[model samples]
Target chain A: MTLLKVEGLRSGYGEVQVLQGLDLTVDAGEIVVVLGANGAGKTTTLRALSGMIPAKGSVQFDGAEVIGRKPEDLVRRGIAHVPQGRGTFPELTVDENLQVGGFTQSAADTAADAERWYEVFPRLAERRDQLAGSMSGGEQQMLAIARALMSRPRLLLLDEPSLGLAPLITRDVFERITEVNQELGTTVLVVEQNANLALKIADRGYVLATGSIVASGTAEELSSDDSVRRAYLGV
Target chain B: MQLFVQRVFDGLQAGAIYAILALAIVIVFRASGMLNIAQGEIAMFTTFIAWNLFDVGLPWWASSVASLVIGFLVGAVLYRLLIVRLGGGHASPLAVVMVTIGLFLMLNDGAAVIWGTTAKPVPRIFGTGRVEIFGAGVAVQVLGLLAVLGVLVVVFGLLFQRTKLGLALRAVTSNQESAALAGIKVTTVLMIGWGLAGAIGSVAGSFTASGNFAVDRNMMQIVLIYAFAAATLGGFDSPLGAVLGGLIIGLVSELVVGYVAIVGPDLRLLPGFALVIIVLLVRPQGMFGSPKVVRA
Candidate 1:
């Protein structure tokens, strides 16, 4: 089942076009990674899909057109975007951060979701009362993911969740992402510059350059491709 | 010692007024990173409304409640009609600041036009009465204002600290984009924050009018300055800091006027402002402000 389908997606900041024409798809209950270097519009693609920016495209999510919707509107429709730079509410406590993520849910549901995420990320539960900003980079990343999960979205869009963390921490982050997909059966479309680790957990992957998808294949095939290795994996 | 106690009591009474006004300023500041220059004028205008209601035979407490509701509506309406178009967070700080200053003048002049330039007496809800504390005779006006401020603080504190709505507000205040991603209605929260500030200001205005025994066009001009100083001293973002800042400014103003021969009564306002400058110089983020930690 195709959870998301996009074609001819055009978006950019004012006077500078990025993601000129891009196409992508993600099946339900599968992890898909979009790999690209800086300025490759990987972030732009996620931003466009989340309705955080204006875009001219046809985005079919769960068989409904999702383009031209507000970010909040998109969240209600079961799409949650864990934005770049770990968009955690710094001043809010860890528990409060999760609570805000459940802004669209009922009070009882929010509490239950919080409890569920705490079981998945116990480090977060221990530091639940601490401010998000005061936490280390790795913990903040975990909190950001947990916060997004609070919405109980069918599709999760993660943009560079591994940015600015140690190699060990990055590996742990990937393990959690894999767990989120394998256990919950949540569809994921993650954009990453850390291609090697991202592709390790990805079922399918797309290589983005400049603004468009240059190549895409099953994770095993893309990981072995000579061109992809030289360009992104540095193998 | 008697004189000292009297001055301290006078300072606390004055501080109560500044504390509420500062809280009003802090609320708006937290929601929209702009200093609302019109806060004082808005309060003054609402106080005039209370006065008119009293003139029509409404009890003082009833009139105040009516004024607060009007204040809330006026604030929400103004944000939707005017401030929203001004581009809120995306707008230039200077442009936003200028718009508020413009509102300050317009609201002041508008009140004068509607109510006339003459002063009107605002009856105190708790009539003329006195209480003795520590050998100091205190008017019911002072005690009443303190009691009202206390209740307001506890109510607002609980609202902001314990409720889910408060969590949404804090999220919006900390990061607007993230709040939107969290499915919190950013614009609605901002509007409500402004409305609450206006309602709070109504109380401050009514209290000011009653304590001073009159409401006039320029009633809040000096009070606004004191409130601004208080907000700045308290770290414009911290509500607790605002209260402490107000009290500190009040005490400094009263003490300087009472004890400083060189400053004289005419220059008493100088000490409070001087304290602000000194504090800012020493601690740029104000007393209770979170030290900004930027990482690359």
Candidate 2:
């Protein structure tokens, strides 16, 4: 039932260790969110999983070992990552940004895929030709997610999707995450600092401290747990 | 009046050479963010190779074409083996740049060892002809200049506009870390960018050979200064700007040398360098680059 498995993962920039023995997983058709504060290795965990950093661990996606593989190859294996800050290709049009997501797809096939995603996100469709940078933070985030989906990945990695947006925009992005989950059955792995909202939507969740997971449980259990409520969810 | 038009046309033909080298500089800059002071040196090295191949019984066309292929491989392999390692994050910025400057010397001296130092004749690709229009005579070389410029436009336009490779290269330029996250290979694309530009460098070298009508080891470095002026004048990443800037510098240089008899050929370098300073002073973004707004 597990689609991704991370075990004993350790990684870092030059001399600083950010992730040490990080273990986590996302089951098939599940939305698993990793909740943490800044410098808790949340982003580093995502980066390590995506193979952007040097790491010592095992990351198995759909039964294939992916720890040291190139990031582009990870996407080819049906794992799409929408990085933090919504790293949209600013100079390129919304549609062109989406096309970059589908880099591995045949040009002929991608043209067809674009029309389909346009139907799913109408605002993106309307602004298909507009530059990504001209849009609001929320819209750029939407485009980044839509762009990643263009690759038709089985597992979608959403890194800090709600970071730096207004509450309305945050709610909208969260709403869209559930929509994408229901509509496409995308197995989503989200990393967030907004524990309450993330836990509300995530079927299951993990808590990371520094670089290791301290806890894991169903959303309902984590919401009511004393430590979880005090440390995160700010209740 | 006829004399003025003729001077402009000849200036444009020469400007066309600067534009080619300038564009090569822009390509390498976009890929690695290095100014590549050695661009001209690499071109000169390859042009000498073409000349040697020609002397050894390869047809003029074969030798030139062969040089382009060799140039591409050399540019790519050189980057993979030397430049990229030096370009790694830990390397000092000045050290990397000075290494390229060192390459200029090594390639310059190296060429003499392989092909000797004397200048050589390159048989014309278009033969000889002249077309008169707008009160001026345009040699086939001038038309040939237009042809080469047109080819660069078409090729690079398609490269940045339509291909996945172009997308990957641009992505590498903007953010190498995020680009790696997206599964793009930074090293491969960087090498290709160098190789593609290297091949283009040979194209420019061939143009300088045939249009300028002689090729030599010293040619690329001299023209390199003008190409740098053009590249800097247009901003480092602006390909169209480099070409237009080159033509303007070329025309200005010719006008300065011709109309100002007191400043004749000996002082020709003055105007080109002056234009760069003026452009930099007026619009630091160069003539065509959009100002980048860096956010925290």
Going through the candidates in order, state the TM-score of chain A alone for each one: 0.98, 0.96
lDDT of 2 at A63: 90
True lDDT of residue A134, candidate 2: 82
- How far in Å is the alpha carbon of B237 misplaced in model 2? 1.6
Maximum-TM-score candidate: 1
Q: What lDDT tens digits, residue by residue, belong to model 2 across residues A148-230?
A: 88788889888999998898889988998898899889999999998888998999999888888888899988888998768
Candidate 1 lDDT for residue B196: 89
Kindly list the per-residue Cα lDDT of model 1 for residues A109-219, writing each as its tens digit: 999999999998999999999888888988999999999999999999999999999999999989998998999999999999888899899999999998999889999
Candidate 2 displacement at residue A5 in angstroms: 1.2
Candidate 1 stretches greater than 4 Å from native: A231-235, B293-296
Runs in model 2 deviating more than 4 A are A232-235, B87-95, B134-136, B293-296
lDDT of 2 by residue, B1-296 (tens): 88898989888977888898898889888766776778888888888888888878887767778878988987898788887678553346577689888888999889888777678887776667888878677788788767878888788989987789998887777666656655677888888988988888887788788765677878777788889888888887888898888889999999889898887799999988888899899999899976763332
Clashing pairs in 2: A71-B183, A72-B183
How much is the TM-score of the A chain of model 1? 0.98
